[model samples]
Target: MSQREQAILVVSASTDVIDLIFDLCEQCQEASLRLLVVRNTDEVESVLEHHEISLAIVDCSTFTDVEYLNQLAAHLSPMSTMALLEEGTAEGMVAVLRNGADDVFSLAELHLHPQLFIGSLQRQLQRVRMIEEVRFLRESLERSLDELKADQHAAQQLQEKLLPPPVRELNHIDFEYVLQPSLLLSGDFVDSIAINEYQTIFYLADVSGHGASSALVTVLLKNMTYRLVRNYNRNSSFDIQSPLATLHRVNRELLLTGLGKHLTMFIGLIDERDSSLTYAVGGHHPMPVLAQGGEVAFLEGRGMPIGLFEKPVFDERRIALDPTYSITLFSDGILEVAEGDSLDEKEQVLLAACGGKNLSPQSICDFIIPAGRVNPDDVAIMTVSRV
Candidate 1:
């Protein structure tokens, strides 16, 4: 409600009191108050039924039963202001105020100095307006929060659709992964694709931040991988099998988008016939762990983060894979939730978990992020094995 807009309902049986209120309203021209004069309780009830009142001034002397005043105060809007005019002592004024009246003034004193009553009325009206404004702002904030949740839900659905399958079998190797975001949208992404009869490619990326902006880069990364596969099929010049070339292309394209964001990644290619695994790393922490012959250790490779440098060099390392071996990759978010006093201890815990024979995406999540617990960052884990 605006400051100038208010309907003042004045209830009094005495014509002289009604006339004095009208005179006071006229004298206080800046108040811009509208008046509704009622003679008795029955008239007050009738007016309240049909119209909304902002301020109600009741003459207590005119009411035969004070219980009716309580009922009238209850029926007024929660933000409405009420003042009582009574011909009584200070104790009577306190009783009237306790009964729901915001303020109470003696009729005798009002007749002597009407300005005091007018000033009190103005203050009560101002408080009422402030309450109304606060209520409106709270309602608006709730609506915005609801809209944001809906948008985040939609984005989450889209990101899920873009995710690679949780489990896949190609040739003699098996691929499985998990992607979980601290927020509704994830910054981590994983993909595995079969390029030919003898080769398959898989990669995991963790964008710098969480939520919508980082999630968008994951989409771009997916599209870039898809386009590279298409180009590899068409032209011999495009080399999707080389992990270093794939990372370099992704870095160049991401920089071209001008998103001002960077990501750590691990891209790898598997050869089914020769049992060879070649991979490159882009500043990813807790590097991919290779488990073979009851031993687990981190892969050897390091480079600058993608989309941050123009001519960054990434090293491609190759290792012979045993018939029964597993390679596990993770985003840094897992280290954040691991229970350890130091970074080395956390890495040891992860290495132990990765070396198990029955390592799965669900197991990794359950071990790192327990039920009823929240993660501080997006978590991603991918495992490729041949057993």
Candidate 2:
């Protein structure tokens, strides 16, 4: 109930009971309550619906029996206290109390103890003040939550723009990817960039944590890669197309940031001229699948994760590429939902899935992500292929 609209109901057939309450209100000026005098039961119900009644003072004598008082108390609004005026026996007093009367008074003793009526009114008003304060705090909390959601949504959009398109054609090699975040922002990131004419560099990275903190690392990763490419174009560096050198440079920059974050990455350079792929692994799992000539298998390599140790070592491995082949890379999150009971069993499931689908990112996503399913962790799928 609002502070300025606290109404109190007085239900009595005689004018004496009503007069006594009015005189008590005048004597107690601290609790300013609007007095609602109603003579009958029906009038009391009407006032309760339209007014925010704080307390209801009912006269048991006006009712036919104690049953009426029982029904009235049960039907009053929640948090509204009910008091009774009954100059009857102890049996009647207990009956009225069980019927929901917070306090009972002997109407005959009012002339001797006028203070009794004043004390009860003050207590009931105190309860009303507590209710109002709780309501105000609840409303304020809801507003704060709404504002936080809005900020997260805006950050999500900017993160999406930092990466390359979902599908791209670079250096005559087709690239496609699908990234699904567990939260409003994703820790998994993917990108493909062309260097010179015959070579293309592409990578998929998974940051250590899940939400906004991990997402911030992705932004920094993209910026560092962009700076590397800019330096190469200006002839200041040649690490962009070298998988081993690129990983070392990334490790050095990530350590300098001191963001307390680490990442597992699968980075590769595809060369169409020699029909070869040179790749390096940074503590990644479910290694990229090589599908060629009706046979599919995982490539080989493992190293310490980037951004972890001061001098993390990584080795670049080369594989002979066929004229028509597809290489698929995925974040470890893919294993969480893979069809298996253990990690080894899960790896087999993924190899089987990619082998069956012939290493298509779209086909892999269809088999992995359901129409309305939310994965427990961030999932990133990327495919570098040629027909």
Candidate 3:
């Protein structure tokens, strides 16, 4: 196989300097030096455009003007500049170096240190190749990122369409909740549907994973929840009006799909007649902390997470809803928050944020999610208030 050739751009105003540069570049063991001789500095830019030129040798002996040298250095970038200086032009040599020369070579040094000159030229060529490679890779990465963003937008639109509204109005009471995904899309899904005039069933499910894969399952969950709730609400002679059964069913549906997916959920049934709350949870974290009148405690129920085992049993728990209590549920991404000067310290800081009075779900999330808590995963939070 033929090794790829390395290119060098020799820009000189003097015939003698041009000759020296060509000799040095050609003598180098593995360089394809191309002579780009221009009497004027303006021509350097045009020649650079035509050739896959890497290292640039600017002959100071050819041009008395320093501005042209500056322009050449600026256009060529820093990786490929070699300034040729006359015997007494120390000031000019310094100026070229300041502008952005890789190395300034004297006429005598070019003659005596032929190997050194060739080595410098080869290094410049290598540097230019590296720069070009990095530029190509960066542009490719940016293009990939743009395509990903477009796909993410489409996924978000699909997920939003699948979600029921944040708040649903019922006959005797109104249900309101808020959901925020840590990433472009979240695994958290919430829905509310009317079963009867006096009773409504609602639940929040946090699917495992983030991004597109986690988001696809949301559509299925939304359809299944609405259908089951609506069907149950229509029948009056139903004894299984509990959150555990709902989660159990959701688990089965998820498992049957064979997508290797699972979810942690808090499903609830609210009876408007006595303001009673019945709910079940499935291996979820940051358990619903029900708070009222400055008192807060974690809500708990027993159930294996959906889709883990073939047939899992769930426990349904009941609570009395007073005027000021609120229910909060969250995904694991919240626990994975980053903060502090280093980032990991912020997670510990959130522990303090969760402690206090007059705590609402939104408040807890806001305190924990600072501007710098950008990890690669998704975070989600949802809440329902009984007012």
lDDT string, candidate 3, 284-329, tens digits = 7656666666666667666778889888877788888886566665
lDDT of 1 by residue, 202-229 (tens): 9899999889999999999999998889
Considering lDDT, where higher is better, how would the candidates rank from best to worst?
1, 2, 3
Q: How many backbone clashes does candidate 3 have?
A: 1
TM-score of each: 0.88, 0.78, 0.69
Full-model lDDT for every candidate:
0.84, 0.82, 0.71
* Cα lDDT over the full model 1: 0.84
RMSD of 3: 6.5
Model 3 bad stretches (over 4 Å): 1-7, 16-20, 29-34, 48-53, 86-99, 107-113, 195-199, 208-220, 223-242, 253-261, 270-278, 285-300, 317-387
Stretch of 10 with least lDDT, candidate 1:
77-86
Q: Mind giving the per-residue lDDT tens digits that candidate 2 earns over 1-387?
A: 445656778899889878987887778655466889999887887887788766778887778777777777777645554555556578877888888887787776566676876776677677766776776777887888788788788889989999799888998888998888889999999999998799889999999998788999999989988888999999999899898889898899999999999999989999888989999998888788888988888999988899989888886899889998888899988887666678888787667767764446767877765566668888888988887
| TM accuracy, model 3 | 0.69
Error (Å) of candidate 2 at residue 378 is 1.7
Model 2: clashing residue pairs?
none
Deviation (Å) of 357 in candidate 3? 16
lDDT score, candidate 3: 0.71
- Could you arrange the candidates by TM-score from highest to lowest? 1, 2, 3
